[model samples]
Target: MTEILEPENCFCQLASGSKGNALYVKGGETAVLFDCGLSGRELERRMAERDLDPTTLSAVVVSHEHTDHVGGAGVICRRFGIPLYITEATRTGSTKKLGKTKAMDIQAMECGKRFSVGSLEIHPFSISHDAADTSGFRVTASSGAVLGIATDLGIAGHLVKEHLSGCHALVLESNHDPELLYANPNYPWPLKQRVRSRVGHLSNEEAATLLDAIDRSRLSHLVLAHLSEENNTPDLALAAAYGVLNGSNTSITVAKQNLPTPVLSF
Candidate 1:
């Protein structure tokens, strides 16, 4: 009989905020990065800290064209010469902002199709947002472990809920609290309404409610991502999910805008 090493699959947030966002996923010797929002230098520094080399990264996937998500995409693609993957809508918007130089490397992805990269199966599912075309993803590793990544949705519909069920780990958005948004002194009325709109961002309560509806039996790690700087706080987001998660056996962590949380192994 031979002792077998369990397959290693992990996800880590490189950055998440109004400024920029990225998530790095690795399994075995094959690794795929989901987004590249931070600058190439910053991305290099983070990768080095994790003992990862950017040149060895398999591919870079884009969620949408928002500056916070695609700001550093071009830089990463250019620096490493990695193929950039995105939907046609995302490519159009990215082209306008990131320019033709970066857009040249983009490989368009079908929103509902599941594609393969090394040993990881990448599925890009549609997510409701103000952007032209945005998606959440489910990456199934060769070891049979699944990781669900979703963010920047105004509401999680049947499509979103059904796709996210029974995942080993998740990076879900808990962007803001409704009350906090209303009382916040900075945002004007129109901007505030947009933030609370169905096409805008999800409130902390919404995120919590979605978690409650999810089948948590197989859930190991749940990370609350994309908090608003002015309108949300970690304590409040934690409190929103605390009640539902109190008796449930699951580990919850908050993803900071500035600091990287420890890589979660699945």
Candidate 2:
């Protein structure tokens, strides 16, 4: 189903964080969930909240094997009979994690290769995350609108920056504030190290640096996602972003942990 008469970036972060994560991005004739991190029921409710119908989805693309990214993939695929796209390594790693599903089409994809799902052209790139294999996506809609989604990643290296550059919109990871993370008494030293590792989430500074490095001159929309509830606050995250993007026209929205952000059109 076409969302608009003209080609535009139709996007939303259904949910974002450790508890769960999901995102919706639509093209004129094709719609997809970048990650279905919630249960089937919860996913349905959120979609309903956004006025999105599951029947319209062409596929549920899996970025990695992490529960926060792949939890609802199986159930949604089974219930709706939507196609599933994932790398072979990611599919294998998610076996036990993503429950069971009916006999559905499982498409294999690899980093550096580009594929299309109806109206969206997608390019998957390697991302540094502690998964069997994690992918960051750069998607272009039929309208020629480009969107870059890179979350659940540790470091934003040269490859990631190259892939994400010159997008009309981006959903990036601004996972935590380093000071809060280090000082949080509830987290053990080992857990902190893991979170601070090159394979872990991005801190506010790291996220800002990546933003500054990327070619955001053409970027109109920015959604900061996968924030840590225990160690990060919206104010802190926004502060870092605002500092770098000062005097810029790019709209910034920090994704929420409990609710979905309003539908964003670019």
- Can you give the TM-score per candidate against the true fold? 0.94, 0.96
What is each predicted model's overall lDDT from 0 to 1? 0.84, 0.90
Tens-digit per-residue lDDT, 42-114, candidate 1: 8888877666667878888989889889888787877777788889888887885665563457687988999
Which RMSD does model 2 reach against the true structure?
Answer: 2.3
Taking the tens digit of each residue's C-alpha lDDT, what string does model 2 give over 80-156? 88889999999999887767644777888899999999989999999999998899999998878899999988899
Shift in Å, residue 41, candidate 1: 0.9
Which candidate achieves the best lDDT against the true structure? 2
Model 2, runs deviating above 4 Å: 1-8
